[model samples]
Target chain A: MTRRIRVLIAKVGMDGHDRGAKVIARALRDAGMEVIYSGLFQSPESTARMAVQEDVDLVGVSILSGAHMTLLPPIRQELDRLGGGEILLVAGGTIPPDDAAALKAQGVAEVFTPGHSLEAIVRWIEAQVAAARGQAAW
Target chain B: MQPDREPRPGTAAARPADPGAEVEAARRAYEEALARYREALAQSPEREGLFTTLSGLPVEPLYTPSQPDPDYLAKLGFPGEYPFTRGIHATMYRGRLWTIRQFAGFGTASETNARFKYLLEQGQTGLSVAFDMPTLLGYDSDHPRSLGEVGREGVAIDSLEDMETLFEGIPLDQVSTSMTINGPAAILWAMYLVTAEKQGVSLARLRGTIQNDILKEYMAQKEWIFPPEPSVKLVVDTIEFGSQHVPQWNPISISGYHIREAGSTAVQELAFTLANGFHYVEACLQRGLAIDQFAPRLSFFFNSHLDFFEEIAKFRAARRIWARAMRERYGAQDPRSWRLRFHTQTAGCSLTAQQPEVNLIRTAYQALAAVLGGTQSLHTNALDEVYCLPTEHAATLAVRTQQVLAYEIGVVNSADPLGGSYLVEALTDQLEAEAEKYFRQIEALGGVIAGIESGFFQKEIAEAAYRYQREVEAGRRIVVGVNAFRQEEDRPPEIFRIRPEVEADQIARLRRLRARRDQGAVTGALAQLRQAARGGANLMPYLMEAARCYATVGEIADTLREVYGEYQERAVI
Candidate 1:
């Protein structure tokens, strides 16, 4: 028996371009992952609380309004503070290379850009979450 | 055209008298030719692989005249005639070219001002302002929640002082400026009017558009401040005020640009935008304003996507639908009210980050569609826009894209160049029918606001987006550099980064303005705005007073927030 992979697709802050977030949520759900979507205008603290409360395996934060540097790191720290320290943090949207590197340094496990496929994201999340649980090798 | 749908008298009876025998002869000839066409399709070499637009509208292998072909005059009259399928204006692009308005903003007010001057120097006709996220969401630069977001995406505008700097050297009456602001559009619009007053321009001479279509904000763009009722009231306030004072300005640019960018189908974009426009018109009528007084200035904004013919069909269908509805359904007696004037922008969602330069080709084609489909104004997206704000070179190229089309392309020689083509007319009719289907569904759901509350528009858009991605992933849809042409590695393009100091600089400026402005006047004006929000009075006058006194946009918005609550929607994905 295998545990279902649970994930939270979060849109933090005031970036209202949620197309990417919504699309990825459905893709992950179709791939058999239990997904929790934090709608819009969510603070970093509330996102972290929702991630912990939902007991998700990963938190995929999306920001396209070019505020990733000011918004993503706090979500990472808040998730760590709320006892979800090991929860995988992933992000995507108009993030530049330097900011992507900085976000990685601050604790984002992986970063995707506009060109990445939904399949690639799903595969990466499944591999990382599956590896963390030490589940059977598919 | 039907007499009831005609905007002017005596135009319906002008069609040539029916040629009874010739019409029958043509019908028989068409039926015989159609059988041969079917035979050719069955024996085709490639079998014509599933040709369809991104809207899921099936495209036929070939189109020819139907039995008893439609009368030309009835279907598409003169460009300026009723049911304006050909175009809204008769002298389309001959007297004046479509406004080359590129949507540009980033960094501080001074930086954006420099860019605006540079664009004007490069022959740009109109100024389209794109506010940063904080300004778009109605937050002051110094707000704690505005942390790293000030001036990141667009220009940071916090007060009348910032608006003054934004248009310092530029005269408002000289060039039309369009602001891409919703949510707090009333607050920002008040700022512009006050800036015009400071610039010493008459309010009656002001011309431009405010993207104040908040119904779409709740349904698609989702940058709403107050809930539906209050936000719509504010929009009506602007329309009412503009009709009286700023007679030349377009108060509400009912937009489908954001809706299409939000991953809706082309037909859904057409349907949803017009439905939202209807909602605004009904709101104004409910407020006891004449349809003609405010409806003429109500313009539209649409998206030009990579689907060449599909996008054109959407535009044509939009014009015809609007004209018919205004004249027949709403009984708008004014000819200007019957015309649907829209500005088109090449779709940002169509631009891929990979092989970023190829986005130029996509944009050029999309701009061509907009021109061929009769856009009154256009903003071509730059290649670098997918990753960051466009660099100067890229933005210039975007402006140049329009210049070449205007000068060299000869596309503007006549109105609706593809007007009479069998395929184009059929597709236009198809799109109109499809849009009517969606309109009926929306009406059944009680209206645009009700549909938003029930999450209907959100769910429909999500499904379409998912379907698109699934098709792309399954190799059914080929996105040039992303899917078909396999590039081993993308050479990272040169990126333009907004300076990190922008956030701090804007915050300090906002704090200083708050510190120096007449505190008592600010409080008094905002109090008045709040009172008007609580009562039945129009809020625009109060907002203008507040803006004239250097009241921050957030202060006025927050005061209204105290009166009318914020909007919150459930996640639909």
Candidate 2:
């Protein structure tokens, strides 16, 4: 049997608040994905470094500490430099819609907000993984 | 004292004589009450805008004999008596003030130790250590999972060596310590024990608390190293171990603080936290330990949130409810078992980053509520906590806030000053009823673990949080800096910035430890741990061994993951 999609869930910067990140991690795990949850107060460099080393298919960054204005873009830059730009990057937290759009433009595949259902997040991940695999096949 | 004469609202006498007249009578009574309230409100327009609380229990224009007569002794007995709603102790802060513990830790162990010493010298009565991300998640400083996260957020203790340096000068016997760690709490606790032993203090002599409440970790906190079943087993092991070894130590502080911070309302926090405590009690019962043996040492931690009366009522109700349940349902014989001793931390989530200094005021209010609610210990959040780590100056002021309340403020002179007040009593009764309703719902759902799996608790918290946020946005609730009084001003002067090199130093120390520790001994112990994990044996003893052998938190967690696999979050949303 093929292996399940492996994901690493992380919280970057000074956000000790981990409710949203944890819920998403649990949801992803329930969707039959292998998950490694690196707990709170992580820096972008550290998160990116862990993602690369863990060899996860996706890195889910949940930041609510408002440091995302400085943290996320550098993590995206680091992932690209590490040659895992192909790896899926998902962001979630208290991001405003406009900022979320900007983050997606900067290469975050998707952003899950507070009201987003777990089913929606799981389905989105499955679709993203499927789409990536399809592109690779082509 | 006198016989009942007239009927009050919601009572049978207040209703109409005939069944058919009920709705009309109710409507007329409501209209009359509204008219009377409007007439009163015309004089003071400012009173019209104020809400009673998040619970939607309306405040009366004036409470008189017409108001409901509440039971004083039944609802709130004398302090230190059965149904301890007044206060845990009769004297309270008048005799001894609440322990002013500043949760301080960041950077290297030496740095945290220095901070601890500094805070102690500044008249802080107790120490509360905050571990970094890696240590909390059971990762070593040098783990691939650690990276630039080592000591930047909080102190990183990889082994006994780090633990030793963390408490080098502090006498564990003289002052109590509280570690806000959950995932690897048992290991960290063992490290503390080993440190105390090295310092010539017996394990029995040490007094401290470990946030070993793994149920909360799964339900709200989400910092578990193992999955729920095993995680709870580990917690029970700590409870069992502490009961036998360290009588003075609080092995698990079943925390409602995190649940409240996770956005649960006061009642939800109370109900859910109490339910979690019951679940832990049941787990210990199954472990073949007597209730009174470990129950006295079991403590609780609550968040004193922005809702003043709601928070106070929640605390009062929690104590009464726990005492009743422990005595009646659980048949716990000991008076200590009946007492619900808790530590209160002012809600960190209520602090806003918009106007940082405003957090000090918010924290002070919450701290006052905690004091009125009668917490055994308290930690006031620093002003800059909403934005960054608390600088020495900010933390000192936070500690001083507690001291001022303890000394200058005469709040502690009398126990439960608001105990007999009609408003507070009514609110407490309402809160107790609401919590009871929740208890029934959770019971129907098969208790806390089942409620967690079904996402019942999470849904309630989310809905309440959403409603509260809406209230804030719509001006129903006012946070001075967040929704009102909006302007950028001079920021709080004392904000501490963690030096990035702290992570480098941690990693370097981790490397040296790995190189120096006997590789053969480490491997042998790890092999034994792997065998034990697969054998359905208790993981705590093996974890204790690992901690004794100076195994990094990550190595043990990794090995457990290899054996038991990791948890999968089922999408109840």
How badly does each model clash, as a count of residue pairs? Answer: 1, 1
Q: Could you give candidate 2's per-residue lDDT for residues B493-568 as a string of tens digits?
A: 4446677677778888988988988877777777888998788676656776776777877777788778766665
TM-score of 2: 0.77
Q: Model 2, range A14-126, lDDT digits (tens) per residue?
A: 45566666666766776799999886656788888888988888899887644454678888899889877878988887565566789889888887765445667788888
Q: Over the stretch B1-573, how does candidate 1's per-residue lDDT look in tens digits?
A: 312333233233443356675465545544654464345434433322234444667544333234345344345655666677878766566546799999988989999999999999999999999999889888898887888888988999999999999999999999999999988998999999989988899999999999999998887888988899989999999999999999999999999998899999999999999999999999999999999999999999999998899999999999989998998889999989999999999999999888888999999999999999999999999999888999889998999999989876567655677887768888888888889899999999999999999999999998898899999999999999898996865577778888999989998898888889899999998888878888979988999999999999788888988999988897788
Off by over 4 Å in 1: A135-138, B1-70
> Which is the leading candidate under TM-score?
1
Best by DockQ, which number? Answer: 1
| DockQ of predictions, in order shown | 0.77, 0.10
Best by lDDT: 1
Off by over 4 Å in 2: A1-61, A64-71, A78-138, B1-70, B490-494, B533-541, B571-573
lDDT of each: 0.87, 0.78
